[model samples]
Target: MAKFKLFKDRKGKADQAKNNKFVKLGREIYVQARKGGPNPDANFGLKTAIHNARQINMPVDNIERAIKKASGNGENVEYDEIYYEGYGPGGVAIMVKCLTDNRNRTAADVRSIFNKRGGNMGESGCVAYMFDQKGILIIDREKFADLDEDILMMQSIESGADDIVTNEDSFEVLTHPHEFESVKSAMEAAKFEFSSSEVSWIPQNMVGVEGENAEKLLKMMDAFEDNDDVQDVYTNFEISDEEMARLG
Candidate 1:
């Protein structure tokens, strides 16, 4: 199993958990409604979004209000989902995913962050070829004590999943983009409690950063994640457990 040192400590989890769920839910509603329709039951993406929002303890009222707002007559905030590729310290490839109403504003903000962090943003397709976009489903381990790993794996494979990884705290299932819904439904049928399900870019190869370079790269990643417009960030960098402990 490949362990990501970036998520080693509980500090990031605690900090993110404090973020206002209303705001997050609002963004999700906006994206889903804009992409599909306001009705979650009729829209698979919207249904997934709402499910994920609830999983994070977002208030029901907030979720409802967001849906209502999206359906009602209002200034439609047109969000364009954009991805930026760049190289951080030690030549670690980084990909940032953002949803913004203005592409120019988002691009400038991303570029500024990269520049400040001693990194440079690259042209489109520069670093993207090094990654594969896949649907990832994450589930909490405590929910299923008697869970049959082999059975779950076989079910996922039959439902179009490409791989499965079980960790100490969670189980991550990977699937093709088109089969995401099917695989997710299979897991749900098996009574699995999903923590999150989304399409993300996974790096095919990883770079090893150490010493000063690793510190700088981590700081840059933190800054990118803190941006309001930024939704997700992916990188192909591997850090050892010892490095994670020292940083933590």
Candidate 2:
């Protein structure tokens, strides 16, 4: 959910590590294009990666360069997509997504972060059962000032979206992984702009974290995010807005 601790600030915000974000996004673009070819129209994953790049204001030149590299112009070395599951402080389930050239190095990096911060890295499928891969789309409330809530719901439902969620500030549309593109196209056709869109590992339930454990967990998460190989990190932990503000 958007209210989840890390995502609350991440949503509609510029990434803190811009250069790392560029590398991560570029690698994803390259992988998708390499696997499915440079044509986004025929490759759903590449199309989604491109949309995500634009959402973060990645330069068009950077995106094109990545495509070219992936399309046989550059080294074209394969990067492996790996998932590392672990438990953070206070039993918080953590799932890390990575694109790496070296499995041993990535595994060691992830394991060290877990072990250093009162966490335990586990075997594959360790905590993955707690999450679902869902297509999430965030719509800024101010962007479509004239849109009615009912109309938005109708469009989302008819477009094959799985669920609609809302907060005081924005609307979120969820869709199955297979239906993501069709739903996104429908929303775009209706002129609805998204603040963010991605197929991510969404936690099925949330765990509460506070006090020192929360502090340690945040540090651990920061370590993971700062890793060049780490692409995305998901955790089941949640903290109140007040607690989050205080952490700041």
Candidate 3:
């Protein structure tokens, strides 16, 4: 199985990075609620938004405030979902997801970042072809110290998961996008707690990056995540664990 790279925080920035994630999640909840009513039970998008927010440990008060702002008649700030494809250092394919109130501003900002950071933004569907959307559920090892990996794997497979990848500190259950909900429900029914869960873009291949290119790419990623309009950024860059430690 290929080890795909997902967006992650760089060393020494975990605190600010997590807070940034909460802001993005709050925006997502507000957008989803405004688009599909505030009721999570009735609105699938809103429900998923709330789930993602909770996955990141977003505060309950913040979640409720976003929903309230969306449902109430007071504030009206419509956000548009936009995706930008690009190439970062070492020719690694990149995909940026954004929720913005202004298309032109977001596009300009994204393009500028790409231009200045050893990258080039491309048209829609440019690098999107290199990725497939998949659902991932991560279970922490310490959370269930007595859990058997084999039994958990068997249960996940029976529950519709396609595969289970064991990492040093966690178990990652993979599922087809269509079967994600059923598998998640089954695991929940089995009392399995998830460290994190999401339907995300997975790269088809990995492109190795090192030295200056790796540094440049990491900076580019940080730039995108720091943008208020940007939500998520995905890439196919593969940096060795050793290189990552050195970079840190």
Candidate 4:
């Protein structure tokens, strides 16, 4: 399998990371609802945010509370969506998306993590141009044991998918940002379900990281995700399978 920037593996720290995921996801849902209103059916962003939260088994109560907060029935905090760009230990481009009520605090925390982890924060557009914003939907192979890859590819293409990448355990459908909802809806109408779905900044090219640099890069990403203000992170770094095994 190609070493794409899948951040699911965290050097055996999945449990720790998951504990913090709910808070960040709650913030994301709140921000989305606040921006587009609390009605998920009428708000695509809110619907996607709620879908992602549910995918992780986030509590229904938490999801509803976030919507209530956004609707002015709960907390009145307003968050700003911000993006930070930088280079990791191996000169791999990294972009962090944040939703925070306090910009200065989030900026300081991000900069400190980067500096302490053998990285340096760059100007706003420094690494943004190296990535493409696309919608990615992942379908597990195990879930559709009888579905052939060719047929899936054909369906994806006919539904306006930009590309279909067959990974070792799943099929990743890529779509233009504007066409994401259409493609996803078409697949759902055909009784297909996604393992995960999101619009993300995909790296145009990957930079290999090994040895000490790879370890440091992973730790750095964990730090970013552990932060309360950070919503998601994107990177161009790719670690070898051997290195990943060693890290595990």
Rank all candidate structures by their TM-score, best first, as comma-separated numbers. Answer: 4, 2, 3, 1
Local accuracy of candidate 1 as per-residue lDDT tens digits, 54-156:
8878878877777776776565677778889898887878888887888888899999988887789999888898898889898777876677888878878
Best by TM-score: 4
After best superposition, candidate 1 residue 15: deviation in angstroms? 4.7
List the candidate 2 regions with Cα displacement exceeding 4 Å: 1-16
- For every candidate, C-alpha RMSD to the true structure in Å: 2.6, 2.7, 2.5, 2.1
lDDT of each: 0.78, 0.85, 0.84, 0.85
Decide which is better by TM-score, 3 or 4.
4
Q: Which pairs of residues collide in model 2? A: none
Candidate 4 residues lying further than 4 Å off, grouped into runs, are: 1-12
Worst 10 residues of 4 by lDDT: 1-10
Mind sharing the TM-score for model 3?
Answer: 0.90
Residues 17-46, candidate 4: write the lDDT tens digits: 776888988988898898999999889888
**For candidate 3, lDDT tens digit of each residue in 107-169?**
999999999988899999999999988888888887778999889988998899988878788
